[model samples]
Target: MTMSITELEQALRALRLSGMSATMQARALQVAQHQMDFLEAFSWLVQDELDRRRSRLLDRRFTLSGLRERKDLKDFDWTYNARLPKREVLALGTLQFLDAKEDLLMIGPPGTGKSHCAKALALLAVQRGYTVLYREAHQLIEDLAEAR
Candidate 1:
């Protein structure tokens, strides 16, 4: 037997597919408007669910990262930071270093945007599905020493 829309929505919710459940009604209209076939409509629903899950996972990672502040690469003041390696700094956003087992250390005197860059990269790593435990260098060393 075919399931009614309400039953289908309930089943989706029970399965924790809230994204599909919430968007199914609106997506159904899109399917009709676009004259989509069954497979096309189903694909749309699945894509929406996947995108929503990715967004939610990113948010959760950001929360768990314990970052003092949220920062974006685009928000950095490029104009004022002319001497800074803009290309190199922005390249960190690609997050290739983690894959290569590279650790980034930004050393500079205080007030040279060190904290800003560190926090921003940490945010990128978390958003890119990497588990990050953000801790100050001093704090991490202290913890390690105490553990020993």
Candidate 2:
């Protein structure tokens, strides 16, 4: 049945007079009327909106661990590789650089998986929910010149 404002006020008064606990008083308010139910539903909708916004901001701030696919890092043999020291340090540095919104440079001989490593790292950054852009160094410069 519909509950008028006056009825709601009476219920509230009764609840207070009866010394109902705060939790019970809140539940009583929720059950006061169909309108109260609508209000509660609207509040939940707003809360969901806020939560989504917060999640987006967090995603922008840090790479989410979920973004790194195992396949991406699979080809690299971490063991028995003489270059392990450099690549390992670079990987750790890449994570820190991503967090700080910094740049990374990978210079090495051809056929050394430079592009593959770059793509894997970029993908990792993407998994972390960070905004990422990737391009060959020459192509990026070309684009910049064209834009200018």
Candidate 3:
């Protein structure tokens, strides 16, 4: 039996597949226009669901992280600090340290973009599905004292 688009969407929502439900009308249109076959449409719906879940997960992670600012390593000024090695700093974004279970420490004088790099790396970690807590040195000390 053929189901209406609304009925199919309701059924998908009931199955807890909101992602597929959301794109159902569009995919149906594509199918009706013969732009996509049934199997191809099914694949697109599944991919849409996966993408939605991944986006939601990233949003959740970002919310849980105490990051006040969204930073990207690419936004960093390589010319700001002549002593800072650009290649080495960019490599940290690879996040291999997370897999190896290692901690990162950045040390430098003021105006050296230490905080910027740290925050950017933390953002990267969050995007990669890792839990992150970001704090300045003073704030970190305060949190530690409060916990004691």
Candidate 4:
């Protein structure tokens, strides 16, 4: 027989009270606490799956170690330049755009760090549990061409 939400919550509570570690208790608590909001709980599960996929795609071996080492976004000069107000705004806007599921466009002249900012934002997105893809415009075009 299928279990109801209250039954699932009771089972989870039992697991938590079974002398589990703090970590396990916390995990069990989340399951028990969200039983009433199944849709939100399901969305979190889907987001977690997407995050796992993105992590696999962005495995350390595949990333530029040097770029990944830069901890502060301010270290990049383009992040400060006055000419590109919109890109900077967009960088800041990522906070507002968290889990927004919208396309982002960054356009600029060559050597302007458009790619850098995009990479940084994509990294941030992944950290915030959103799925992300980072690719050069030319490479994406070529990929589409090959697919056709």
Candidate 5:
């Protein structure tokens, strides 16, 4: 017996396959249009579920990271500060220090993109499956004091 789309979606939801359930209607339309075969449709459904789970995991990580902005290193204005060590900043973006288990300290005068760069790097680290805690120097000191 063929299952109705609603029944199928209900079953998928029961199985906690939210991603597949969410895409099932669209995939069904594609199937009806002969745009996808059974195997292809099944693969797409599985991929959708995986993508949803991955996205959710990233979201949770970002929430736990205490990062307010979704910053990227590419958005930094290299031309604005010609004296900035572009090479070093780019190297930090590579995240080698993470593997080396080292800490970073970005010190510069006000309005020199210190916080911007740090936030960008922290965002990258969170995206790359790392847990991060972002805080300003004074905030860190306050947290330390509060802990004592």
Candidate 6:
């Protein structure tokens, strides 16, 4: 009562196991020739599915995030704005306040990295699998006014 590889592949495809079905032939060959265990081969196929799903999810998140460019919190230079509290800015990167349903305000004079920091935080939120909508201060105010 053994199933042929073609039958198994068809069954896997019918079950929507594209990742497993696509790699099944090569993986099965590896298992037979390299003495790889069934569990190991199965896990690799599962990992491929998981990785693909995760990447697609991340892409969707980025597209909906309204982020024009990727910003890195680590790239921020603390030396330029010595007066700015570095710890406070870095703490925002952790995004704990998001869980508590809190809002953050970044206020500073021009050329003080306020926008950079805000964008960096937005990037962090997006990377952490949170929905982010970024808008300029004036743009946000205008939207609010229109809503009124």
Candidate maximizing lDDT: 5
RMSD of each: 2.4, 12.3, 1.5, 10.2, 1.3, 3.1
For candidate 5, the lDDT comes to 0.93
* Residue 38 CA displacement from its true place in model 5, Å: 0.4
lDDT of each residue in 48-98, candidate 1, tens digit only: 899999999988888888796898877887776567788899888888999
Clashing pairs in 1: none
Q: Among these predicted structures, which one has the highest TM-score?
A: 5
- On residues 16-86, what C-alpha lDDT tens digit does candidate 4 reach at each position? 42222213334445778865355555556445545655566556533532234323355567545568665
Query: lDDT by residue for model 3 over 39-138, one digit each (tens)?
Result: 9999999999999999999888888888888989989888878889888888898999889999988887889999999999999999888999888888
Pairs that clash in candidate 6: none
Q: Which pairs in model 4 have colliding backbones?
A: none
Estimate the overall C-alpha local distance difference test score of candidate 1. Answer: 0.86
TM-score of each: 0.81, 0.45, 0.90, 0.47, 0.94, 0.77
Checking candidate 2 for backbone clashes, the offending pairs are: 63-128, 64-128, 67-127
lDDT of 5 by residue, 35-91 (tens): 999889989999999999999999999999888889888999988888889899988
Model 4: CA > 4 A from native: 1-72, 78-80, 86-93
Judging by TM-score, tell me the better candidate of 1 and 6: 1
Q: How many residue pairs clash in each candidate?
A: 0, 3, 0, 0, 0, 0
Question: Weakest 10 consecutive residues, lDDT, candidate 1?
Answer: 108-117
lDDT (0-100) at residue 57 of candidate 6? 80
Over 4 Å off, model 1: 32-34, 79-83, 141-148
Q: Candidate 6: deviation at residue 50, Å?
A: 1.1
Residue range with the least summed lDDT across 10 consecutive positions in model 5: 107-116
Whole-model lDDT values for every prediction = 0.86, 0.59, 0.91, 0.57, 0.93, 0.86
